[model samples]
Target: MSFLGLAHCSLPPQAESLRQEVREFLAGALAGRGAAARAQSWDGFDPEFSRSIGARGWIGMTWPRRYGGAERSALERYVVIEEMLAAGAPVSAHWFGDRQTGPLLLRYGTEAQRVSILPAIARGELFFCIGMSEPDAGSDVAAIRSRARRVPGGWELSGAKVWTTNAHRAHSMLGLFRTAPEAAERHAGLSQFLVDMRSPGVSVRPITDMAGREHFNEVRLDQVFVPDSALVGTEGDGWAQVMAELAYERSGPERYLSGVQLLLELVRAAGPAAGERARVAVGRAVASMVTLRQMSLAIAGMLEAGANPAQEAAIVKDLGTAFEQSLPEVVHELLGVEPDRAADTDLGRVHAVLLELAPCFSLRGGTREVLRGIIARGLGLR
Candidate 1:
């Protein structure tokens, strides 16, 4: 409960060694890809690349061995992910499954669910998307209208989810649905279900972003039937479950590293002859990344120790996203290069795409205002 007590964190000796291995792997795997490709970062989807990483037993590095995991520590997994992001590896194909869904399944899913799904995720043969936000819900989890009604052997789910990343390509979704009528407690009556995207009556339609990319999707469920085995954890416990999952989603390197290529591009564009302002700006950006990394690492350490660091995760996400969103603007000002989407240079392509995508960094994980509220409530300030 002490917000002032920042947990001390340092990579273990094994983690230090593992970093070199990951870097070497990235070098060979990412050979011809330039900064523009790296700028896509975790959002870049390459199933073949994901399968290659999985072949190395890097996908489920921290899960239990029985579930096809490597049984490594979270710190080890942290090093792998940091290296992947830093090198701008195309990790999106298996990123969500590795980052949160697999962990959540291990924690709250049935044993049968774990045995069936975790191994595929580790093998990079299956992908998962979260089903939290609805057309009406956005960040307000309590406002979701997607509901499930009992139907003998299982339940019938009917409603839609928006902003579902990779839904078109995902094999399954950990969907949140209302199981009962709204009660006096708004967070009550919510439930989580393991939805098979390929099931009858389920549909996925891509939603193109301003950048003309189709990473997000609108998933519609019209009386989709799921067996009882699909229910996750106890009934009406999804609110708590979703909150825990957010900690995993929001505290990672992706929160801050979205615009890393832009910073690198800035340095490349403003060579040694650049003015003092450019140097100072680059230094300041680097410092911010360092600070956020420390905070995120602290949270990762806590998670490794079986501790709930939701509050700390919120703090990292809020500040990390602010840093990410502002980086492109800072780069534009300091480098003074007009971003051209059609430009032949790596920096130009990266700059143009980042300028369009930067605004989403804050909106994607959790809005700045929502995250700040979570942090305040955790610190007893609300």
Candidate 2:
């Protein structure tokens, strides 16, 4: 088996120009935002901020114009996302819709679904949450026990989903349910649906994190009925469709930029009088970030070329999340500062928040073990 290599990819001049526009917009929008708030990273939810982003035509930039996209290049979209993440903007409101759901719909949804959903998502009016993990199954998506039974008009779903981010606030959920009995193949008999959050018998319970935030949720569905039109792609093909979606989830700059607020704080705390060791540690962290960005950009290029770089995306997410998870510890060691959320200094507060949030960096998109397994299988080393 041949090993995969991430080719160097450069952003176009247009993409850089778009970057400047995003920067200018964020400068005014994110003014007065403290480091503690910024430390929330993409987990920060602000619907108004998201709507403003939509008005700027920054969301769903790569989809066709008919679906409220600008029909811009993927690289342009990448630039916008990079800037948003780097600025530590509150983007969770539209993050799932713009990052994966819109693209998933464009690929697998019916024309009606696209017409009804994509425009709202592009306008940042409709928010979505993913329902894949179960109480028992986390990163092992195939082991999910959520079930959907055939009904007169559509399907009746009855199951529970855990760690569903923003489910309480989302208008809809892209849920994966088992439609048939378990077969010899573990991934068979699954289907995807766009379930309305307001449907009868659907309940959401927020899961507070170590940081005392409530972005994560546990969703329960008791025979929640969904119309036939809500079915995404062919029945029983959810495994393949979900795999494609994971490529989008794992290939973005969010994987690496989660702890950036802490990094910025470290730089502020370590002034020009910083010692050589501090400089070296900061330099190493920056170098890792740059390399991961290059790899992520390569995945975007492959995506633009109509290729599924699932393995490449897995590699980037694995490495990128590792970098993010390590940053808080590195900063603590370098600055010799104890993490205290109530501290008066920006660095202390940022560091404290990141210490709480960093543990989830690898657990969210895909666990470290799961990502490494993907990379190993891709390299034929398994």
What's the TM-score of each model vs. the native? 0.97, 0.98
lDDT of all predictions: 0.89, 0.90
Off by over 4 Å in 1: none
lDDT tens string, model 2, 1-382?
4435567799999899888999999999999988888888677899999999998888898989999999999889999998988888999999999998999999999999999999999998999999999988887789888999999999999999999999999999999999988889989999999999999999999999876788889999999999899899999999999988888999998889888888888888888888998899999998998899999999888888888888888888988988998988898777786778899989889888888888888888888999999988987888
lDDT of 2 at 225: 93
Taking the tens digit of each residue's C-alpha lDDT, what string does model 1 give over 306-376? 88887888888888888988887886776577789988877788889889988888888788889989888
Error of 1 at 221 (Å): 0.3
lDDT score at residue 325, model 1, on the 0-100 scale? 86
* Candidate 1 pairs with clashing backbones: none
User: 297 in model 1: Cα distance from truth in Å?
Assistant: 0.8
Deviation from native of the Cα of residue 139 in model 2, angstroms: 2.2
